[model samples]
Target chain A: MSAALDAAPGRELPVLAVVGVGLIGGSFAAALRRAGKVGKVIGAGRSRDALVRAKGLGLIDEAVALEDAARQADIIVLATPVGAIPAILSRLLPFLKPDALLTDVGSTKADVVKAARSALGDRSECFVPGHPIAGAEKTGPEAASADLFVGRTVVLTPLEENTEQCRTLAIDLWKACGARVVLMEPDAHDAALASVSHVPHFLASVFMAQVSGADDADLRLSLAGSGFRDFTRISAGSAEMWQDIFMANRDAVLQELKAFRALLEQTESALAQGDARELHELLERAAVARRFWGSRSGHE
Target chain B: MSAALDAAPGRELPVLAVVGVGLIGGSFAAALRRAGKVGKVIGAGRSRDALVRAKGLGLIDEAVALEDAARQADIIVLATPVGAIPAILSRLLPFLKPDALLTDVGSTKADVVKAARSALGDRSECFVPGHPIAGAEKTGPEAASADLFVGRTVVLTPLEENTEQCRTLAIDLWKACGARVVLMEPDAHDAALASVSHVPHFLASVFMAQVSGADDADLRLSLAGSGFRDFTRISAGSAEMWQDIFMANRDAVLQELKAFRALLEQTESALAQGDARELHELLERAAVARRFWGSRSGHE
Candidate 1:
């Protein structure tokens, strides 16, 4: 570790390394830079051109190899796809400084935790799994913003081996990015997100595919209004990212999907039987709950 | 009909009546008034207090009984729930002038067409079945706007018995409100709407119900980001309105639901089997189509 970085310990600004410098990593770097909480940002990703662009856009102070970044960074953020977590963690473990804190911005928690445990072994104490519940359909560094995490939630799934210092620093990092940090068990986080995030994105994609594959797709698209537009908005997200999420969070997502399908079947039965009272009750329950959430969230 | 309305025939501004002065009806009245396309707007609904409020808000010049409005109005708009179409049509026909024109802003056209044919009989020619594909989750006259239909599509399912003049006038009325009017078969409109609008709303409502019904609903809702907010926005719409729509367009909605469920099963199977390629392909198809639509709609 650098003498300057160790001079004041936790009080000093972080020398951050962001692997996979895409939307999530780039935005984190930008947000911390804007808040004056990051002394320097080192970016590492598969694409050299993207890293150069990120540096040109001032999202990073330097573009370096993953091993070099891990060796020097005070804090390392693995912001790659969930499927890449294990491999990347394995690569960085050999060069990671003993005092350095490690965190990630993958969507699913349990899988990432497992991957970290398998890859880092005893060094897993330095890693805190996280997910920032904020994104746009747009991708890459050019779409990154300094305020992307402002007023958003960042979930941290701290491991049993994680020291208090590691957990506290992880929380502070996200908080400095203008996000509210919450602690959760990795499994619980996965299940809850599967219900709220994963399943919704999956359903939207399935619906979009269904509509677009129809014989009269052009006609249907032409007639679609704002309802369809908003309902399917998340389906425009990166396919590889969603694929990793669905695969990584398979069990929880499947459980939620099963529950959702059961509810849908009930609704279909009500409509098929022309049971107006039952249908109205079902819709009313949903409408009431949605309005309550919208009001509380200030999204109405 | 008034002598002033009859004096100039098609050239004179018509005395308009909105059967249910809620968002759709009130907005139509407000938009027409803003465009100076109507001589006066009469409001009629079950809620006298609401009608009075509409009058106070200047959404209508008068509040009267349905039959009274039917007798005086040169053009009448039935904006009541889909289930009310037949009963309202029956009550209005006794007092409706032979030269007067009638239309409706129901979400489903097939059922409305059937109701109009049964209730209006030969006079169905004067009643053009229309569905303006625009709305907000809010209801009542207070939520109405003078430009709600601007740049929106209004589908007119013209009856076989309707005169060319009736169709033209219906088209002109929507055009004056700054909406683009398109002609469609009643059945075709219902099928297309079920695919794009009705099923999406139903699914959103169903998903909302699922999330709220979960044991950890509060946690899930708290963690939900912009995607969940937008995905469930339409679920907050009026329950009674959607109930009426589902019942009225039961067949088409059920068919679309069946198709959607099938696609969802395919996704589930892929996820269960860990078939990454299949899942990626499905997500990519949806992503491409949704991106194209979003770009075209200027929502991205």
Candidate 2:
């Protein structure tokens, strides 16, 4: 830490350029500020209104041009959806300083890493891919909070040739936001997230839609309490954002979805046969497993 | 409403007998008293400790023997788990006045109604099988709040033989708790609930368990966030309770589960084939449907 500080002749507060000031970027800025860790936070996004909102909310100290942010800041956070990362990286790569750090908050990373390796060539060493396991169904700067990442896990998938400076700084940024950082391979991160996150997103949306489909819609919505609300919350997420994740984590998302289908078939067969005993047992097992899951996830 | 009130002479303030005193029972008792809709709340449970706790929490005005409650109360609530309804009705049947109102807060009905009808014989006409579509992932008296049913749906499955007295009382009880009451056939109610409630519970449990079976348990849990938690919240529901619901709503639960399975398979095949366009279209539809659900559900 002392060596890092001493490396510069004139000590200036570290600057992190946050691109696409939506839920991830805005919250990243707030979390960094709340911890009193990073020095200067610059907000950048295609949406001038969102950047303004991010700045006014004190999520960032200043609004900086995306290109300038890439060149001047010591760290750059591309907080856009996964599909947007490749194009954004292509545009920002040339503008980035030789030693500047690049990272992303995309949910799916295998595609991001591949895109980065291809687009940035040798400079891929400066890019680190990380995802903070923190979000809500709601979006935009307003939904972002300083405590969003508190006690949440953040996974970083650095390429084999990636520099320690890039990886360590990336880890430190997440840690400063109160996240417990873990390192994993890009494919592993993508696959695990598909099972835990993206697949659930699709499942939730489909189930909610199906329930609302069968006549008496208003009555059904009225019947829906917290259980239905919670079960289907993710279905309301940014459509395009989920599309990006699905495209990126395609293989893994489908794999988990397939497994879920098999389980559903067994449940369906029991129900179709009016085999109350079998249905009861399966539901019981599911309930027990889910109880364990609820307990485990509730505390976190 | 006015006729029933004037007809029943006011002596000793008619007690509202609550048979379970778990989250649902305690919440109902609190809502009834706090809303000034009931004269007294009588709590009953097999466990003396649970009954004592419910009474101590001001969830009930008194904790008494089930027979005593059945004897003293003008309104009786079988708020216990569905499976317990049969035994409870059998034990309390001989003590219930034919004119005294009886209902329930079970999640699933038809079977509970059928079973209780057998127990009470001809007097079962007074026992209305009701299920308030309200609850939290949390359970027990400690988890109870008077506002649990506020602005939520309460489905009352009335039988063809249900007297006007029974239906009116059932609606009034739920309305007192700020619920929007709906009257449906017991079978239809069971079918609709299995699709909207029970199916979601099993899907959630299966999704979580599939990942739990993976080599990395800790990693899986760490990656799960609000989306995963919300989707699987019902998985934490009582094992025995869900078991009973599955048996009761077997036909509908199976049908919904099958539909969910077919969709899940389609999703998987799309991914396996790298058909991003197909996946995108499916997810986008869910996302749109979910947006309406979110506004209705008041989700963030």
Candidate 3:
């Protein structure tokens, strides 16, 4: 933290550059800007149109090349899709300032941790793996909001190689964005996320597939109401983004899916056998459990 | 429609009786009362406390014994748990008036249809089986709303024994409550609802079971957000009610569950094999299909 402060000299605001200025990245920049903690935000992306749009929306102070942003950044935040993080890190490595720190807001952490090890080599100590568990059905800079991360959980899986100062600085940055930061091992983060996020996305998508594949799909869809709407909301997310998350966290997601399948099979067998008592117990248990969790999470 | 009109005799409001005036039944009574289509609403339930509460809340005009309510009724609406419908219908048979029409708001149609056939015998011609596709997280008479069925689908699966007059009366009743009436065979209603509602309920329950069964459930749940909240909302439904629904619609629910499991297996295999394009295509298909359906359903 002191080293970062030393590099910034007399400036009160830190120089921040956000790579892949989409929803997450743009929101982070906007939040930091609103907090008056960022000196200048340079947006980096493959699309000139998006970068231009982001700047036009005041989500970024300037739009520049990825390497150029990296060279001048005091803190670099990668907000690209999970699959694009590795290559972007590789590209930013050469131009990365000596005192600059790197963090990401990707959905998965273990993959990012591995990518950092391979791409940063000796500079791996400057990188912190993080994921802000916040998103909407829509994406892109236009959908970004300064308050998106407020009251949300941001999990950080810092590498053992990362310096104490680097980790502290990354945590401080997420805090400044109005997020609650929690620390966990990369594997633990992946497993937990597999249960909470990845599996739900896949389940919703599968349910959608089942309904749409039906012979009277249009008729069935016509009868679907609020319950179906909420249940399938996340399935409407971008395929490119979700596919990357699915591919990156394959092992953890597979384990969760297997567990879910076992539960579903149990329910199926109970229903098939006309075991009303057993079915009742299973549903009661789940309903009670969900209510408890919802109350604890303030959702109920 | 003529028979019902003939029975009414004059310009008098119809004498209505509501059996098991919980959420659905109570809502129907309230809506009809609001529309001035109903005269005296006699509430009947096993729970005396519930009946008293319904009367107090104006969900019913008075509380009475089931037999008494059935004797004086011009129309009867059974709004009980699916498992309880059969016995309730049996109990109402001896006390039923010759011109009294019968309807129900059970979640499963086939089971109720079978129950009506067995219970009413020759008088099954006057019994109509219907389901209002509306609900809330809460239950009981206190949760009843006059507009609960407004703009919602009320599916009627009339038995072959049902006279045209009986069917018309039930349709008119639902329409008076602001519901859009759709006629289908009992089996079709069960199958369609199994696809759109029952399976989603169980899937959400099973998903909740999987997550809550984890060793670090508290941690995982804390990390869950709006997506998980919406996906699992149906899982928080009343256990007694859903269990009965699952049991009553067992065959149809099982078929939908099997279909869902097959779709899930496809997604799992794609994820396991690291087939990014396959996963993307699957997700893309689900996304596009959901969007199309959502647009048509006016939910987007």
Candidate 4:
């Protein structure tokens, strides 16, 4: 499937501009380069040092200003945090090529779509909001890999204003990175992510913070095993990025958190009442579901 | 350190019996055999098929009844689910050798210690309540590995009635399996484990149950990425074992759950109120603590 995408006959390899060349952007550039699916790659970010490092690593052909990138590149990917999306979109709108396809690697899609609509107006037709569901806790160009998106999923919430050409291009780009692309409505994407990604990240951070705040935290951490290690792995993600995500997708995340809290309360009540049957059934349902998911997803 | 323990001079290799013959028991017997630290291994469990498999795997020299194992072995390790510990202890008490050392690999220490005291009376001194801080979601003898305890922590809660010789022998047994052994009070061990392990498992199960029970569960599961995979990995654990753990360490797990709920509420309030500063600080604190722990534990 990826081979067909990578070997697109008669399709021109477009010049790619990756704004905010951190793990996500750097990895996208690296993946496309490995697949021989792009022309020159231009890196742009607030961090000059990161762009330089990305160029040195050959993930990008050159480091350029965001405006220069928007003016020259045939495709531009905004890979910055959700909070920075609006300002960056506004900055690029003036220099953006009329035919250039624009997309984002933001975690929250609805907010990014809304920001693009506000910033680009009618030009929003060129934009496709995307989220590649793959990452490590590690960040930055140094941690980026060409295989980061292999066998991962990428969700694209194409705006009604988006041109069919632009949507196709965005899907092809991720497919070339060895990712399975799924399309959903912007709100649907937000709600699904809130349940699967956003709320899980928030809960991990909350759990980690609670444990760390305890007086006997050092002891607790020492006794922590592989289970704790895996459970709180996402808590090590960048604070700024997560804060933006929670704020950007506020309603969906809040709803999911409420649902989670209700389940937690039910569990607590079961334990308090010494309801072994209830507790076991709850755990059995979860275990069966988790094992089934793991089997289907090949994650176990 | 492990080499020192593995090469204990002039110490006679004990005839070992592993009760339950599952992941924990099978692995213990396998590790001791690999280190040449055992004379023989007798496996005892409720499942005759599991015992047969364990014996075929060479994890045990023979399969025996609990009474036969207790009478024959120099060291008996109760590596069953916490809920089964009391019943197993009662059955083994009649035939337990006077000079034999006893230990357990139950997740919760205090309850196991309590059960031992009730079942064995003065003989409880020979039972060192231990928890190996290592596991995978997969259970049974087939999942057991000789290296399962390597570089892991084995926490021992030695009773005040425990003989010095019995305690040392228990510590050495774990050390021979390439584990780092630490002594902790049973209550302290329970509390720390609740914070780091038990509560995290419960939360994962609760979250999984909530998501699985959702109307759009298939969509949510499709979008679930590596973060969700790792966060819910422990939820795939045996339901019966976890139910036993939650019930056995009820107070500590409940206390930890209350603390987690409080922090979760604070986070929800911050998000609801759009208190970005508060939310950012909480996330940052967690990120810092998680990264520090990851670095120290070499888990990242």
Ranking by DockQ: 4, 1, 3, 2
Clashes by residue pair, model 4:
none
lDDT: worst 10-residue window of model 4 chain A: A1-10
Best by DockQ: 4
| Residue B238 displacement (Å), model 4 | 0.5
Cα error, residue B157 of model 4, in Å, equals 1.0
**Fnat scores for every prediction:** 0.87, 0.66, 0.76, 0.92
What would the DockQ be for model 2?
A: 0.57
Worst 10 residues of 3 chain B by lDDT: B1-10
Model 4 CA deviation exceeding 4 Å by range: A1-12, B1-12
Over A1-300, each residue of candidate 3 has an lDDT whose tens digit, in order, gives 443444354755678898888889999999988876687889997888889999999988899888899888988998887788789989999998887889998888888899889999989998998999887566899999999999889999988999988898889878988999999999999999889988999999989988998899988887787788888989998899899888889999999988889878887887898888888887888898999988877776
lDDT of each: 0.89, 0.78, 0.86, 0.90
| Per-prediction TM-score | 0.95, 0.91, 0.95, 0.95
Q: Ignoring the other chain, what TM-score does chain B have in each prediction?
A: 0.95, 0.93, 0.95, 0.95
**Candidate 2, B44-84: lDDT as tens digits:** 87878889988888888888888888787778888777888
In terms of lDDT, model 4 sits at 0.90
Candidate 4 residue lDDT tens string, B1-300: 212123356765678999988899999988988878787789998999999999888889899999999888888898888899899999999998877788999899888888999999999888888999988566899999999999999999999999887888889889989999999999999999999999999999999999999999999999999999999999999999999999999999999999999999988999999999999999999999999999999788
Tens-place lDDT digits, model 3, residues B1-300: 333344353766778899888888899999988877787889888889899999899888888888898888888988878788778888888998887899888878888888888888998999888988887566889999998988888899888888888877888889989998999998988898899888888999888887888889999998998789889998989888888888888888888888888878987998999999889988998899989878877786
* Model 4, span A1-300: residue lDDT tens: 211123356765678899988999999999988888787899988999998898888889999888899888888899898899899889999998777888899999888888999999999998999999998566899989999999999999998878878878789889989999999998999999999999999999999999999998999999998999999999999999999999999999999999999989988999999999999999999999999999999888
For residue A45, what is the lDDT in candidate 2?
Answer: 74
Q: Please name the candidate that would achieve the greatest TM-score relative to the true structure.
A: 4
Instruction: Give model 1's DockQ, 2 decimals.
Output: 0.80
